[model samples]
Each structure stands twice: as C-alpha cells, then as structure tokens.
Target: MLKFTAEHEWLKLEDGVATVGITSHAAEQLGDLVFVELPEVGAELTKDGNAATVESVKAASDVYCPLDGEVAEINQAIVDDPSIVNSDPQGAGWFFKLKLKNASDANALLDEAAYKDLIA
Candidate 1:
C-alpha cells in the first residue's frame, strides 16, 4: 500500500522495502519539473530529512524522507529525464526505495483521503 507524509513524500510498501516519491500535489505546486536529484542506494535517511531535490521552472523543493531507512534503490530514469516526475509523480516517477528501519512507520503515514485534506 502507498502512504504519504505531510511533507508530500509518498511511500509505497511492497515486501519489506518502501518505494518513495513526491506526490502529484507537490509536482503541481512546483510547476514544471526540470531537474531531479535522487538519493543514492545505501544512503541512510532520517525521517523528515532531505532525501532528494526537485527543481521546477518556478522553484526548487527538497523532497524529505518520510521514514528512517537505508536507501535500497533509486529510479535512474528520473535523473535522466526529470519531466517524468511531473508527468507521472506516483508511478514511473518514483525517486527511491528504502529498506525501512521500522515497519510500524508505514502504519502511521497518511492515506489518500488525509493527503487530500492536507493539500486542500
């Protein structure tokens, strides 16, 4: 299942790892993404810490880590083509995957409805 942080990072859990990305709301807010800097595999990430960065025509935004974990993988495709983030924020646009240090954190993340409330 996919869960979201108030900061706009989304985590999609599968097996034991969580795939992370910026939500469509965030992409929309940023305007048109022109660059994306993704976390490296094996990097340690803290909850609420900056894990990635996205630059749009309007502004640059830091993408925060929604949970504490070690980065397991990243989408090199985004780095090669940043606009994919704005085009598909939730799917092919995923930034990275983390090997969660605490699975319980996933339970605590917001669902789609709560995310809508936050964005609204």
Candidate 2:
C-alpha cells in the first residue's frame, strides 16, 4: 500500500524507503511539463519540504519531500523526458526514493483511500 499527500504526491514503501512522485492527476493538472529538477543522490531531505521541481508548460512546481532521510536514488530517464511524469506518474514517473530516518514518518501521510477522498 501507498500513501498520498493532499498536494498530490504519492509515496510507495519498499525496503524501508519511500519512493515518491506526483500523481497522474497532478500531471494532468500541470499539462505538458518541460523540465524537472531532481534531487541529488545522498542528499538529506526534510519531511514535507521541497525535494524536486517540475516545470510545466503552464507553471513550475516543487515536489514535496514525503519523509525525512537521505535520497537514495533518482530517476534520470524521467529528467531527460519530463513527459514520463504525465505518462506514468505512479511507476516510471516516480522521481526519487529516500532511505527513511524514521519509519514512523509513514503515519503522518494520508493512506490511499484518504488521498482518493481528498481529490474526489
């Protein structure tokens, strides 16, 4: 299972890390994005803080960090092709994965059901 932010960020848990990205709905809202600013690997991040950037044809938005930890990896392919965000926001569009400093951070986010309600 995954959690989501009201801001439309999705978080997937795997091996104690949270893989994070914008939702398909968010990509749809942003329209055609032109650029993406990915976090550097090994960068320490703060929960709910800025983690990355998405520059759409309409506007540029910051991707919020879903948990506190060091960024373990980032998807470079998506950086080269930002449209991957719109095409597969949940899978290949995932921006980065963070090695959680505190596993409890998951409790602070909205579960899938709650998130669906938020956008509904």
Candidate 3:
C-alpha cells in the first residue's frame, strides 16, 4: 500500500521494502530542485527523523523518515539530475528504500485521499 506523511513524503511498500519519495505538491512548493542529499545505505533511521535534504531554487527542505527503518537504497538518478525531482517527484524521483523496523507503521500514515485534502 502507498501512504503519505503530513510533510508530503510518500511511501510505497512492495516485497517488504518500502520506497519513499517527496510528493509532487512538495516539489511544486519547493520550485526547481538544485541538489539532493540522501541517507547512506544501511544506516539506521528513526521514524520522523531527518533522513535527507533537498535544496531547490526557493528553499532547502528536509525529508523525514515516516517510519523507523534501515536505509536499503537511494535513487542515484536524482543526484545526477536534480531536475528529475521537479519532473517526477513521485516516480523516478523517489529518494530511498527502507527495510522497515515495523511495517505496521504504514497504517499510521495518511492515505492518498487524505494527503490530497491536506495539500488542497
């Protein structure tokens, strides 16, 4: 299932690992992305912890971990081409993957409908 955080990050769980990214609303608000700093693979992360940083022409934003987990992977494409984040924040622009400490934490996250309501 895919879930969203109040901060505008999205999480999509598949095969036990959860893929995470910023929502398009966040990207739109940030303006053009200039840089992205991702968490190290294998690093332990806490729920709601600062996991990454994204800098745009407008401002710098922190990407928080929605749930506790270990970093399994991060998207290199966005590092190479930050504009990908502006172009596809929820698809090719995904930030990282996590081996969740507790999969049930996803239940606490907002669903797409709720997230849309928030960004609206």
Candidate 4:
C-alpha cells in the first residue's frame, strides 16, 4: 500500500525498498506534466529534503526525499516521458527508490488508510 505526506507525495514500501511518487491528486492539480528531474543512482538524500523536481505546464514542484538514504535506482524512462505520472501515478510512473539510511523512517509515514483519509 501507500503512505501520504501533507506535501502531497506518496510512498510505497516493498521488499525493504520504498518507491516514491506524486499522488494522483497532486498530478491532477499540477496539470500536464512537462518534465521530471530525477536524482542519480547512489545519490545520498536527506529526509524531507529536495530530491528532485517535477514540472508541469502550470508550474514546477519539488519532490522531497521522504527518507534519508542513498537513491537505489531511478526511472529514467519516466524522466524522458513525464506523462506516465498522469496515466499511472502508482505503477509504471514510480519515481525512485531510496535504499534507506534508516528503516524506521517508513514507520513515521501514514499508512494506506490514513493516506486515503488525507486525500479525502
């Protein structure tokens, strides 16, 4: 499942890796996606810090790191085709994975249920 931030990001944890993305609500709010700034693999990130950027026709927004960790991988394909974030925000549209500087960080995020409530 996924967790949400008050800043409108989404996080999904699986097999100890956290997959991050912007929520559908966020994508819709941002309008048409134009570009994506992805962190390089192995880049160290500070929790809640600026990790990347997402640009839409309307504006550019920062995507917070959400956790303190090294970036395990990034979806280069999505950077080339930002529209995927609008069509599949949680699936093929996933942004990056943080290898995790601290496993307990995931515990601080809201769960699927709470995230749903947050958006609603």
Candidate 5:
C-alpha cells in the first residue's frame, strides 16, 4: 500500500517493510538536487523524524520518516546521482527501506486522493 505524509514523504509498504521517498511535488519544490544523504542501515527512526537529507540548487530539505521504523537499506544510486530523484522521485530515487515498528500505523497517513488535494 502507498501512504503519504503532509511533510511530502511517500511510503510504499509491502510485507513488513516500506520504501520511502519524497513525492514528485516535493522534488519540484526543491528544484534540482545536488546532494543526498541517507540514514545508515539499522538506524532507528521515529515518526516525523529526519530520516535523510536532500540538497538542491534552490535549498536543502529533510526527508522525514513517515512512520517509526529501522532503516533496512538505503538507495546508493540517488546519493551518487541526486538528479535521479528529480527525474523519478517515486521510483529509483527512493531513499530507504524501513522495517516498520508498527505496520498498522501507516493506516493514519494520507491516501493518493487526499495527498493530491493537499498539494493541490
């Protein structure tokens, strides 16, 4: 399932893990990315906590943890080439995989229509 936070983070949950990234709207707002810093594998993250950093030509922004979890993996491709995030924020640009502390917590996040309205 896919869920989104008001902070503009998206989470795709499958099994007990979630792949997290900035939404395309967020990427557009940040302009072209120049740097990305991901959390370490096994790092514990709390809901709404800073999970990663993305710096663009316009500004730097934090990618928040939409749900509490432990970092299971980080995408190195985006770190090596931040522009990938600009091109595909929801796909190959995902920042990390998280082992959710409570998968049910995702239920409280926004759905596609709600998120679209939020950004609209």
Candidate 6:
C-alpha cells in the first residue's frame, strides 16, 4: 500500500517494511538535486523525524520519516547521483527502506486523493 504524509513524504508498504521517498511534488519544488544524505541502517526513526537530507540547486530539505521505524536499507544510487530524484522521486529515487514499528500506523496517513487535495 502507498501512503503519504502532509510533509510530502511517501511510503510504499509491503510485509512490514516501507520504502520511503520524497513526493514528486516535493522534488519539483526543490528543483534539481545536488546531494542526498540517507540515514544509517538500523537507525531508529520517529514519525515526522528527519530521516534524510536532499539538497537541490534551489535549496536543501529534510526528508521526514512518515512513520516510526528502523532503517532497514538505504538507496545509495540517489546519493551517488542526486539528479535521479528529479527524474524519479517515487521510484528509483527512494531514500530508504524502513522496518515499521507498527505496520498498522500507516493506515492513518493520507491516500492519493487526499494528498493531491493537500498539494492543490
């Protein structure tokens, strides 16, 4: 399932893990990315906590954790070439995999329609 936060983070959940990334809207707003810093594997993250950093030609922004979890894996591709985020923020640009503290907590987040309304 896919869920989104008001902060513009998106999560794709399967089993107990969520792949997290900045939304396309966020990527567009940030412009072309120049750098990305991801959390260490095994780091515990709280909902809404800063989980990663992305710097663009325009500005730098925090990629917030949309739910409480431990970092299971980090995507090093985006760090190696941050522009990948601009090209595919919701796909190849994903920042990390999180092992959710409570998988059910994802149900409380926004759905696609609500997130579109929020960004509207």
lDDT of 3 by residue, 7-97 (tens): 9999999876899999999998899999999999999999889999999877788999988999999899999999999999989999999
**TM-scores, one per candidate:** 0.95, 0.95, 0.96, 0.92, 0.97, 0.97
Better of 2 and 4 by lDDT: 2
In the range 1-120, model 4's lDDT, one tens digit per residue, is 467777777888776778888888888888889999999999999988999899987788998988788899999978999999999887888899988877777888887678778788
Give the better candidate number (4 or 6) by lDDT: 6
- lDDT ranking, high to low: 6, 5, 3, 1, 2, 4
Worst-scoring 10-residue span by lDDT in model 3: 56-65
Count of residue pairs whose backbone atoms collide, per candidate: 0, 0, 0, 0, 0, 0
TM-score of model 4 vs. true structure: 0.92
Q: Which ten residues in a row have the lowest lDDT in candidate 5?
A: 56-65
Model 1, stretches more than 4 Å misplaced?
Answer: none
Clashing residue pairs in candidate 2 are: none
Residue-wise C-alpha lDDT for candidate 5, range 1-120, written one tens digit per residue: 999989998999999899999999998899999999999999999988889988977678888888889999999999999999999999999999999999899999999999999999
Off by over 4 Å in 2: none
88-114 per-residue lDDT for model 1 (tens digits)? 999999999999998887999999889
Q: Judge candidate 6 at residue 14 and give its lDDT.
A: 99
Residues 97-117 of candidate 6 have per-residue lDDT tens digits of 999999999999999999999
lDDT of 5 at 33: 94
Candidate 2 lDDT (Cα, 0 to 1): 0.89
- TM-score for model 2? 0.95
Instruction: Give the distance in Å from residue 94's predicted Cα in candidate 4 to where it truly belongs.
Output: 0.5
Clashing residue pairs, backbone N/CA/C < 3 A, model 4: none
TM-score of 3: 0.96
lDDT of 2 by residue, 17-68 (tens): 8899999889989998899999999999997789999998778898888789
* Higher-TM-score candidate of 3 and 4: 3
lDDT agreement with native, every candidate:
0.90, 0.89, 0.92, 0.85, 0.93, 0.93
Off by over 4 Å in 4: none
